[model samples]
Target: MKRLLSALLATAVLAGASLTARAETVDITMAAGHPPVFRWVKHANQTFIPAVNKALEGSGITVNWSEQYGGSIAKVGGVLEAVEEGLAEVGLVSSLFEAAKLAPQNVTYFTPFVSSNATAISELMDRLHEENAELRKSWEENNLEYLGAAIGIDDYLLMTTFPVNSLDDLKGKKIGAPGPAVNWLKGTGAIGVSGNLTTYYNEISTGVYDGVIVFATAAVPGKLYEVAPYVTKVGFGAQYAGGIAANKEWFDAQPEALQNALRRGGVAQREAYHKDLDQAITASLEAIRANGGTVTEVSPEFRMKWAAGMENVAKAWAAQLDGEGKPGSSVLSAYMDAMRKDGATPVRDWDKE
Candidate 1:
């Protein structure tokens, strides 16, 4: 009987130790410049956070998440800085805002008219980060560890107060575009005004701009239809706006098991982001059309003409990077090559030019 009691006591003590070990928690703060309204933010909250928590379940480690979003911890365009400075252990870094800082990483932005598949674009971007050295360098230079990409908008669209039937409709018009995208307006005869989603509505409403080069996903919630209800589907191609990034020091400090959990969660988040983006693009465009808005699909011929008319921004973009010895040309060539291999026939091969 005494031996039985001793055995039971030992079992209870071991169980307590195991429970205590499993209760260990690691606290991490994740931040995003944009609010939780968009698909990227939504997936981060509903999918990614839950995914990580689930991955670590019964692994003797748990994460305490501090989610800061919607310009709460950092304003839009400042996520990279916040993460680099370790203000947030992880963040969603916007390449759109980091054009100058992450030039090579913005290959999708420079070479448009290639893809409209959000899933393909997101997966390709993640694969490129894994395979491309220069792409990896961009993150390392900024003291970030790339996890997976979060592509918000599916394809670029043009919204204007006036209906657009042809390229001539854009002549002498002042159209707003986000950073670096202003180059897309070159040779279109329309003056490109540097603008962001935040100011697109007010700018158009106040006559600060006549139209905007934007996306359907953003346009619907932005209530841009009230100001610029004319939506033109130009097939400007889906883009990589931002992605998950971690402070290098912080990431390296994590245990291997924790690192694996984060990586798994990041990939899951990317997939969720693309699926949601695909759904959002459809729903948002439908919402716009239902609200007395006009949706027009630009002809393939017109798209080709537009692509040809634009300043060989791709060539110049790559050359500028080549001059800086930043692997710009190589990334350009490789990206276009990959797209072609994936059965994409771009209106203009930005790299070959």
Candidate 2:
């Protein structure tokens, strides 16, 4: 009896040790510049957080999430610094704003008229980052671990108070475009004002600009149609806006289980985000029409002419990166090549030019 009691006590102690070893709870903070109303931010909450939690199940690890969005923790173009400085453990870092730091990630923006499939662009970009050391280095240099969940914007549209049947219609017009995208207006005789979604509606409403280069998924929510009622589907091609990333230092210190969960969450989030975006694009256009906005699509010939007439921005962008000792030309070429390989016939081969 004494021997049996001693054995039972030893077994109890071992079980306690096992439980202690497996028990872990990690606290993480996720942030974004945009509010949860935005698709990217919405996915972070609905898709990413839940996916991470699901991945962590049965690992004896649970995550406590603190979400800070809508410029609560950081404003636009500041999310990278916020994560890097450890203000937030994770962030939706907008490469659109970090053009200088994340130059390589802006390949899609420079080469328009290639493809407008947001899901494909997101998948391609995520794969490129995984395959290219130079691309990965950009994030690493910024003290970030670039996860998946590439934030892709759908085909760009021109929203204006006036109609745009041809480039002539835009002459002398003050058009607002997001970063890097402003270059898209070059040679069109239109004045380009650098702006973002947060400012586009107000800017257009007050005559700060006549119209904006925006996407449908975002336009509906922004109620931009109310301000600029004409929507022209210019098909400037989908853009890889930004991505979800973690503070490298913080991420590196996490246990393997937690790290894997984060990565898996990123994958799930990317899939979910594009899925949501596809639906939103269709719904947004319908919403725009329902709310008294005019929707028009440019003729394919006009689209081709518009693309062809633009200055070789891709070449200049690549050259600028090359001067900076980054793989600008290679990335540009690789991106175009990948698009072509995937059966996309670009209106203009920006790289080849």
Candidate with best TM-score: 2
**Residue 151 C-alpha lDDT in model 1:** 64
Q: Over all chains combined, what TM-score does candidate 2 have?
A: 0.93
| Separate clash counts for every candidate | 0, 0
Clashing residue pairs in candidate 1, if any?
none
Ten contiguous residues minimizing lDDT sum, candidate 2: 18-27
Shift in Å, residue 336, candidate 2: 0.6
Task: Give one digit per residue, the lDDT tens place, for model 2 in 19-59.
Answer: 66655777789999998889999999999999999999998
RMSD of each: 5.1, 4.1
Q: Which residue segments of model 2 deviate by more than 4 Å?
A: 1-23
Kindly report which residue pairs in candidate 2 clash with one another.
none
